[model samples]
Target: MRDRHLYLLLLPGLLLILLFRYAPMYGIVIAFQEYNIFKGIMGSEWVGFAQFARLFRSPDFYEIMRNTVLISLYKLAASFSLPIILSLLLNELKHLVFKRVTQSVIYLPHFVSWVIFSGILISFLNPIDGLFNAILANFGSTPIDFLGSSAYFRSILVISDIYKEVGWGTIIYLAAIAGVNADLYEAARIDGANKGRQMWHVTLPAIRPVIIILVILSLANILEAGFQQVFLLYSPLVYDVGDIIDTYVYRVGIQEANYSYATAAGLFKSVVAMTLIITVNKLVKMSGQDGLW
Candidate 1:
């Protein structure tokens, strides 16, 4: 009877996943068909792997793939360790007021919608009269159009994404750090370990499992380079450098109505992401770490 209430509480979440997540997976068949709106799924002509073949043969395929992988890798490299570092630094703060205020200020950006954030970014980065250019003018520098330049676009994407997300990412690390045994720190201090040494030997090792799990999960989305952020930030001027798989699919599928072709591209991303998650999880398990199983 006690377990009955817990099972009842779990039912809604299970139903939601089954209805909205698993049920929709059936649409993946559209990627293998010449889907027509009028004919619908059942009547659509099956074209086997023709859509996937076409996607591979397209001239833009390699460019899109390169841009996607490079951007995601850049973000992973630049932003992954920042939260861990921030959590460590924040943990060392002695003043509660300063720590709380600093955390609140940083975490504020995560709640802002991408649409609003993009607008703010455009206004701030504007070349002629924007804040950045205004500052440059004082330094006697020529105003540079950041968003319009391919050279600067990718950097802007990475930096802005990091700014918005780094604080939120710290939450998990902070929680993990909080759970570390206090006795370990005392033991480290008795061993003549300084603050840095304690963090290295006690705090970081205690949080290693959480870090490993998060890293493995992040690998699953290696191809997903933030669709909403990229879509809102990119322009034709920076397409060569800024376009990713998701944006490419949006342009081809939604804008051009090549649904099957676009679906093939999406399906390709999904398959690769799934394979990555499984492979990385297995590797983590082999290393004696807990995995998503």
Candidate 2:
């Protein structure tokens, strides 16, 4: 049967999935264990929900959770809408050469490491002699250290993340737009629909499914503010707003060697993420569209 060949074609990927993905899932037992280096994972004593209890009791837990959710929410708002906006703007460009060049330049930042990007941002946002501060100084305003200030750190994080990813995100929308029938646009134009109205009536409706799917996926990652960006850019002073669950886990688990506590924290985040994905998927389906299922 044709299906047999298709299964054969997928065999390698299936094997890889079992080996790399499912195999590592066994380590989740550490979340319920009093993990110790000498005792090892299997030898460690079981503690059930004790670690989770301690994690919840920690004073910093609420702060970290708030930071994670708030930052992720900001990113969700900015990231979800930016690509759609960019795709619409790009679609309006009739010049292929200019469009391609602009896309290439914007997508270029995505390939740059967060460490490198953070350094660039620090330099640009420096209080003294920085581009932003220099411009402010010219207008008789005092210099402000954007990166050092807690009030501005989250803003910087969201803006930088948007700048890095929005172009790459637009590629999918652009592809969806390409699949939309050109005849719809022609018909709308003949019916007295302007460019904006044509987009509202035709192009957007056509790509609504893709937008819905991506938004659902984005909500699923509502806890995952970019780890590398935060780790690279944040200092002790700005940790109030910049510290995320991932960074907290890294510091506690890897740096401080509190494996059991870190595992508990990580497991909590995973559970929440899974719950969000499932809930959003159901909502999307109920709204009458294809979903992640």
Candidate 3:
């Protein structure tokens, strides 16, 4: 009876995953078919990799793929270590009030919608009468079009994304740090280890498993540059540098009504992401660390 109640508590979450996540996976069949709204899944003509071939042959394929990979990799390389660093720095703070206030200020941006955040970025980066240009003018520099320039778009995307999510990312690392045994720190102190040495030897090692798991999970989505943020921020002028896979799919699949082609691209991303996750997990296991498996 006790176990039955426990199972009952699991029902709602399981049902939600089945309904929203697993059930929608069936629609992937459209990737292999010439899907029509009226003809439906059962009636659609089977195409069998035609869409994939067309996607690969498309003129814009390499450019879109390049933009997607570069932006994702840049964000990962730049932002991934920041949260760990922030968590460690914050963990060392002795003043409770200051720590809480600092954390709250940093975390506030995470809850803001990308639509609003993008608008704020646009306003700040505007060439005329914008905050950035106003400051640049003071230094005797000409007003630069940050948003319209392809050269600046990727940098802006990375910086803005890091600003919004870095604090929220720190929460997980901070929690992991909090769970480290107090005795470990005491032992380090007794061994004449200073703050830096203690952090390097004790705290970092304690949180290594959490870091590995998060890194492995992030690898699964290595191709997913944020769709909402990119769509909101990018324009035709910056498409060469700012366009990503999700935004490309939205433009081609949803806007242009090339459903099968878009589906093929999406399916490709999913397969690659899954492969990355599995490979990374295997590598982690070989290195004698805990993995998602």
- Residue lDDT tens for model 1, 174-265: 99999999999999999999999999999999999899888887888899999999999999999999999899999988798888988999
Off by over 4 Å in 3: none
Please give each candidate's TM-score.
0.98, 0.95, 0.98
Which residue window of length 10 is worst by lDDT in model 2? 258-267
**Which lDDT value does model 3 have at 124?**
97
Tens-digit lDDT string for candidate 3 (69-137) = 998888887667999999999999999999999999999999999999999999999999889999999
Candidate 1 accuracy as TM-score: 0.98
Give candidate 1's error at residue 237 in angstroms.
Answer: 0.6
> What's the lDDT for all of these models?
0.93, 0.91, 0.93
- Those runs of model 1 whose alpha carbons end farther than 4 Å from true positions after fitting are none
TM-score pick, better of 2 and 3: 3
Candidate 3 lands at a TM-score of 0.98
- Winning model by lDDT: 1
Please identify which of the two predictions, 1 or 3, would achieve the higher lDDT against the true structure.
Answer: 1
lDDT-sorted candidate list, best first: 1, 3, 2
